[model samples]
Target: MPTSPAPLAPLDQLPIRGLTSGDLTACADLSEDRGWPREEHKWNLLLTAGMGYGIDDPAGKGLIAACVVTSYGPGLAAIGMVLVAERYARRGVGRRLMRHVLAEAGDTPLTLHATPNGKPLYEQLGFVETGRAEMVSGRFTPTEPAPGIPTRPATAEDLQAILRLDTEIFGLDRTPMITRLPAFADELRVAEEDGEITGFAAAWPNMDTHVIGPLIARDTATAQSLVASLAAATDRPLRTDIDVRHTSLLTWLKANGLDSIAFNAVMVRSLPGLPGDWTRRFAPLTVAAG
Candidate 1:
């Protein structure tokens, strides 16, 4: 009997380049295959506009075997949109992409929300487990409001103010929300007091889950109100990723009946030069999108 043809060599060992439009399409298709919504098409486009790298198929077959994106902050860097084609699994493609992305990060502290399968790889790269997150889901009713705070859908005039709060919370100036606000299903609510926008939250309906995110507030009560308000807005079950560092909010979530799911891996590769408060008020986008 004739010997079987050799398996395709792993794409990991090759040098990669910047992603092009064609690569984005391939990435989208691969994303769909991985169970992500087709709406994730914007992720590739956003990654290209922001910061990302990828290894393309040499045959111009429109296959992006591996890819990664890094968003820069004042003194930090965040990794998002990481992917390795199913055919290229366990071939060091992720490692290669990470190594390259970190190199380009240029000393900014690197962080990401790693999946269970990715935890080992990140640990091998010197990343340590940092925290947990609770994906709270439940039937919620709004609590009685306190004095002097109001929640409402973000308006055009509120964009700059909301963005400012977001910058302060995430330690970076991100334009994605500002540009995509109109199209996003999220309410992107803001808390106003004395005519000033104090806090903001982006809550939107996912497939079966309604996700509340980047939920920043001036105080725990305000945050609580925002959470409750968003929940009341959606008839579907509500969910939000509560960072472990926010013990007060996490406790509230648990007390209110949101089950604690698995932990979210917060890993950092380098130290940043700025003050450490970035973790205090930092807002999360999502596991993959952050």
Candidate 2:
């Protein structure tokens, strides 16, 4: 009798390659297969502004696993959109992909928001939890008296001021990501005081909800003003992942009819903490790209 053919190597040892814009559909399909929203808009931004990596399935079932890393010039990088096909879960594919990204990232500190199910695996890979973000969603209810802080739609001339504030509070020059906001978001607004920009926020379409994020402000009042203004202009329910440390803002958001959704743990590898000023950084552009 002929000897049995050799068993194929585990996917964990398979070649992982760079993903490009062309792989968007497959990536979205993998997301849906794993019960996540397709997130095509978000995926498009990440693919163009960030580096995507994935491994193809031998069985021709699209990607076996995939992840995206948004780098900020060696000082920091963010790892997000990590996914593994459901059929391949618990087989080490996720871990294998993470290890590869970690190697590719070298000494640059990395951060990612992790769901509960993925937290244990990240910890095993040497990531430690530093913070949490509370996600809330619902139609925002206008209060009896609106925020006194003045806010208005952003313009081309406001781009530089917005970028400066974002960099100062975000702790990195995320020009590539910031520049895309005008087109990506349905509404981009800024809070002003004494003719100077004090804060900025964006609300972009995602499925049935309008997600609010990258909410940077000088204080809680300014953040609240930005969120309130953005929420007022949209008909769809609003969603945002607010840093849980902002108790006042989170509580205020809840009071205004945006129901609590979920909490994601902020995890980091090779860094003591995220670089931004959490106090003024009310929310991330999206937890995935943070």
Candidate 3:
């Protein structure tokens, strides 16, 4: 039988190279095959804001494994979109990719949201569980904009203010990624008070559903108003990933028609400083980006 296909080479010997725009479709296919939520636009955005690597098939067919590393300056780095084809599983592909990405990250504290299936491997690599995040989804009926919480679509003029708010809440400068939000998100809502941005949120398409996240606000009421504005903007199925520590927000989400559907462990390779105002972070931009 053709000499048994000459016995496929071990994964460790696969060539690793920097991933580029040419790899977008293959990367998206890999993620979708693994039931991930990433799409082409998200992959493109990630590639623009971060660096990615892939182990290509020796025959020049396509990628067999891939991983992405993003730095929020030197303060924080995140590793995500780690994927290996099922045919190549259990052959140390994930570990090798993690090692490569970590090397690229230098000494920055690393973080990632880990599914149960991924937790063991991450833990083996020295990641510790810091907390849990819940994935919530459902259709919601938009309520009238909350009084005193003036909201409007974000504009170029509002970019600086939004970046400042994000830095304070996320404890890292993610200006590069945040600046690209308008391209991928259907709406970027900003809540203003006293002529200043107090909160903001992004609503983006995710396969068959819409997701609203990276919701930052000075208080719970403002957060609710931002979410409501996003809901009013779309009647499609909606989803968000929220830290479980925010019980009040969780309750509000459920009351507003969303239900918790999944839980992910927030794992960190090193202890990064806490957000300047953790309470202001109502939701993360995405599990992978977090």
Candidate 4:
């Protein structure tokens, strides 16, 4: 008689491992498996700038679950790109992955933009709702008379200023992610006043639309100017995740042309709230890397 097969290890004991550039395709495949867009471009950025974790399928079905943690120094980190295969839903795969991340993160403050379906699980894991972000998308329709704020394409000289402004408002140093914008984005524009950089935004390609993110400005007028300028340069319809607290800016985006797609819960763990000034922070670079 054939001997009984070895006992299957529990999902919790499946051995989670660190992901690298080599796992890009598999990560994209897992995204597709969950019916989410296979954003290989975004995956590349996260995998490079952040640490990725995943659990492999014992049956050879690619990654069972995966997530990325983008740390800004030791003070803050954003968790994103969490995905689990459709076949393994509700089997503790997601919870296992998250616990691993939390363990690895230790006491570092953590943040993430959680979808409606994801909020409950995250809440159970100790993350509290601090705010919300509305995802607006569409072909940007320019209004008569553009914003008065002066805007121009940013140059190499503007890098330091951008990083400085980003750090001040973002409440953490993002040298690693901000530095990649110059090469990664299709258009990097800055709002200027008397030759000093006042605001900046970058429009990067994500599938067919240009995603405007890291929208940093001195005020509402400057934020509108930066967005308008980025829209003017690109023919592709624009998309960006705007903080709901910025009512005027969100309303302007809607009236100008975009429609609300969905809202993401901005949840934080081990912190009272996200660091930095949310007033000047119009939109994040991407919810994934926030």
Rank list by lDDT: 4, 2, 3, 1
- For all predicted structures, in order, the TM-scores are 0.78, 0.96, 0.92, 0.97
Please report, in order, the local distance difference test score of every candidate based on alpha carbons. 0.66, 0.92, 0.83, 0.93
Candidate 2 global TM-score:
0.96
Better of 1 and 3 by lDDT: 3
Candidate 4 Cα misplacement greater than 4 A, ranges: 1-7
Model 2 CA deviation exceeding 4 Å by range: 1-7
Per-residue lDDT of candidate 4, residues 168-218 (tens digit): 999999999999998889999999989789889999999899999989999
Q: Write the residue-wise lDDT of candidate 1 on 1-290 in tens digits.
A: 99987665556556777766556667777676566564353564455546657777555555555455546554666676677766666777778888887777766776778778888988887677666555666655433333335788888988878777776766677676445654565577878889888777876666567777767788777787677677667777677777777787766766665666667777767652232344445346565545
- In model 1, the number of clashes is 0
Model 2: colliding residue pairs: none
Per-residue lDDT value at 79 in model 4 = 99
Alpha-carbon deviation at 166 in model 4, angstroms: 0.6
Q: What TM-score does candidate 4 get on C-alpha atoms? A: 0.97
Candidate 1 residue runs with Cα over 4 Å from true position: 1-10, 20-25, 35-45, 57-64, 138-149, 176-179, 254-257, 272-283
- Each candidate's number of clashing pairs is 0, 0, 0, 1
